[model samples]
Every structure is written in C-alpha cells, then in structure tokens.
Target: MRQTRFHGRVEGAAACCSVPGCSEPGEFRAPVTPSSFDGPGSFRWLCLDHVRQFNSAYNFFAGMTPDEIEAAQSPTAGWERQTRAFASNGGDPMPSWGDFSDPLDAISARFRPTAKRQAVERFSGAERHALGVLGLKDDTDLHSVRRRYSDLVRRYHPDRNGGDRRHEKKLGQVIEAWQTLKIARAFA
Candidate 1:
C-alpha cells in the first residue's frame, strides 16, 4: 500500500482556488495568524499570483498614526528607569515584582508609597526589604534585577492566582513595590 504524502485537505472550500474555475489543488496554507489579543484570523484561499499580489499590497500597519508607528518602532523605554536601591537600608535592590506572604495587602499597599494613611505604610521602605528578601546585592546590575522581578511577578500575580479577590490587593502592592524600586534604582 502507498502512503499519501500530503495530509492536508483538497476538497470543498479548501479544495480549489477561489479564482473562478481554477481546479489546482490549493497548495499553500494561508491561515492568518492573529494577534494574541484576539483581533482576527480569517484565512485567504488564493492561487500563486493572487497570493503574491495580496502579499505585495498588504500593509499590516495600515491604520496606525505616525506617532503610533514611531512609538511602536522605538525600543521599550520604561525598562531603563530607576528603582529603589538607594533606600539607605543597606539591603540589595528588590526583585522587580518580588513575592509576598499576602497578596491582598500587597495590592492594597500600592497606592501608599508615602509614610502614612495606609495599611502597608512606607512602601518605599518595604520595597527595599523585598529586594533584600530576593537576596540580590545592592550592586546588582539592572538586567539581573529585572529578570528576578519578572520571575516573582509572574509567580504571585493576582490574575494568575485563580479569582482570589484577597490576592488582588497584594498583587497591587507587589507591583507598586517593584515600580518604586525600579524608578528609584534607575535614577539613583
């Protein structure tokens, strides 16, 4: 028995080119890959010449403004900003989004970077402690700090913690801590 080399379908809508009576087996897979944000994924069935023409005329960034184009084309800017290594606590810089014993408290504490009127007061100082907890040295490079921060943020993010409203505040605090540290560290 001979095995068929092509496992793809060549019948019905997938069978022929949409170009009138062209009876060639649609050789190319033209599935449109959509953005992860779920915009659109409509595939086109075209013959070689038509496919080439479509490719030539297609402008993926058609509707965007000049500013949008410029911004999107530029390297990500916020990654280089300072964080909290200058807190005078003598601890290492905090991981980007370090883990916490309580996520609800973390999220709630984000709003209070200053010293008063908040459950987790002195978040700037707490941020310094988080860096110490992560075991990063005060002199650690930005690259290492960001990498560790990303790791902890992913682990404790409230969104990924399965609908625990309690964790939401904590997650926010964790984020705030990282942001404070990142900005302070960047400038200092």
Candidate 2:
C-alpha cells in the first residue's frame, strides 16, 4: 500500500472554514499578531479568502502612539540609529583622543599615540639601518635626523619633487631612514 501525502484539506474533521468554525477547510496560516506575545498561544488556520479579509480589517498598531508606532515599525529603531558626534572642544584638549557615547565611535576614535613621535623617540635599530642605507656618519643626532628627513622628504616626496620617478623610490627610503633614526633615545 502506498502512503497518501496530504496536499490540501484533511478529511472531515469539521475543518470548518477555520474562521471561527464557519465549516471550511483551513487553507492558510494566519496570526493575530505578527510579533510574539507574552503567553503561549496558537495561530489561526483560515481559508485564503478569510485570511485576506482578516488581514484587511486588522489594525496592527491601532492603539499605539505615533512615536511608538514609528519605533515599533522600524527594525533598527532604538540603538541602530546613527548618532552625530558633538564637537570635541567640550572636554579634553585632545580632539582625536576622547571617548564617545556610542561604543563603536568610541572604539573608532580610540587614543592612538602619535607614531611619528614614537619613531622620533626610540628608533635606534631603524636609525642604524637608515644610516647604513643613506650613508650617514656615526655622529647623526635627532636634529640631524630631523633635518635629513625633512630635506629628503622635500626632495623626493612625490608631491614636492616634480614627479621624478626615481625620487619616489628614494622618498620611501628616506622616510624609512627618518622613521628609524627618530626612535633612537640617544638622539632624543
């Protein structure tokens, strides 16, 4: 015997129109509320026609205020809204270094110690390498480092150096050298 698959109405269980027992087969799954309510309940099984009727007559947010309605209607209402950051002048001297009310912005604007300053402070290893590459003598100090870095940057920086292709590569080397020398504490 082949098993019969149920494709439509179940046979003769009073299967009323499913619209409060109007005596019809429940053909559609309809809900009183689109959202989950407090208690466990059941969804209504209705014929397609009645379900359409019920849907047309239903006022989902009938009792809600305008604000409540707006809040409830949107998927991202309360927290997902993007908030504008206020001017940083209100608090700390550091504009790029303060906390934000929103966690994401606070994280994004997190305090980053200036890399250039760090490079200037403790670049001994990088300095030696830079000096070796640039052929500078042992007496180079922070002042010399700054001056050489500035001069090389000016001469080779793509923007400053009339688009010389060779200087582009040279500029990169110069920056690496300067960054290296700047970090040596002895120079500081």
For each candidate, give its TM-score against the true structure: 0.30, 0.36
lDDT of 2 by residue, 28-81 (tens): 666655545676546677765686687799886898999999888788767777
lDDT at residue 6 of model 2 (Cα atoms): 41
Best by lDDT: 2
lDDT of 2: 0.62
Q: What lDDT score belongs to each candidate, Candidate 1 first?
A: 0.58, 0.62
* Each prediction's number of clashing residue pairs: 25, 10
**lDDT for each residue of candidate 1 in 120-159, tens digit (9 for 90 to 100):** 2323465567667555665565577678778767767766
Error of 1 at 118 (Å): 34
TM match of model 1 to true structure: 0.30
Candidate 1's C-alpha runs over 4 A off are: 1-14, 31-40, 77-188
Candidate 1 displacement at residue 95 in angstroms: 15
